[model samples]
Target: MEQNRCEKSTLLLSVVIGVALHGSYSTLFNPLTGPWSIFPLISLVLAVYCLYQRYLNQPMTDGMPKLIFSFFLLGLFGYNAYLKTSNPEMGSNFFSSVCIVIIAYGFIVKLNSVNVYVNRKKTLRKHRKQSNINCYQLLVVNTARF
Candidate 1:
């Protein structure tokens, strides 16, 4: 259960970070106007929440947060890429963003795998200890019967 929570948190954090970066990039390069400008604010809020989660060492267990943010980032990236398709200069920026997101995602996956392996080792050690205790108790009970 803890592992599941950790995994969820890691995924959420990654997505939030990605969105924040993308938002900042958009704000700097494209500068959304009027009501649409609220996007950067929303991204700021998410970035703060991400920091708070990290500080508290607690992550949201629900999958909704990550899913929603992931979709938002995907849409934003797609729209931006589509808009810049005709511009040759923006191609490098788009490529770099894609590479960064991929690297971050890969890192998180590797971290989660390591976390799972460590948790499994701990569980196995606990089981071994319990088995030893049971064996010792049985030995003592048999000796007492004699």
Candidate 2:
């Protein structure tokens, strides 16, 4: 559990750094037609892949909302990229900012759910242990009566 938390935190940190760079460069650099474009594009692809993988790995009922949100953000990314491609003069800062916000929200939601799941597991384990002890106690009492 500790390892899982650490890994998650690391992933979250990477996402934050990627978003910060993307947002900062969107206004100053042309994200569509220069060397700077590569990093943002790569990050976008990576984000999409991660979202899709999460969607697939989780149950439909559990992941549906997140999947929908991921698609929405993906749509926005495509639209923004299109705009940038069509008109190099138009700034993509707004789009990048939007992406950053969506990613942050998604990560927060994911983290919350993970915590909830972990708690549930712990509770279930405790309940099972208690029930087992109760069953053993009842068995002993019945044997004594017999």
Best by TM-score: 2
Give the TM-score of each candidate.
0.45, 0.47
Report the Cα lDDT for residue 96, model 1: 47
Which pairs clash (backbone N, Cα, C closer than 3 Å) in model 2?
Answer: none
Tens digit of per-residue lDDT, candidate 1, span 1-146:
77767665655565566566656666566633112355766776876686566647754444545554554565456545544564545554566469548755855886698789989999999999999999999999999999
> What are the lDDT figures for the candidates, one per model?
0.63, 0.60
Q: lDDT score, residue 24, model 2?
A: 38
Error of 2 at 24 (Å): 13
Tens digits of per-residue lDDT for model 2 on 20-132?
34443564565544444355556666665765665466434455455454545554564455556567687655665677577767768887998999899999999999999
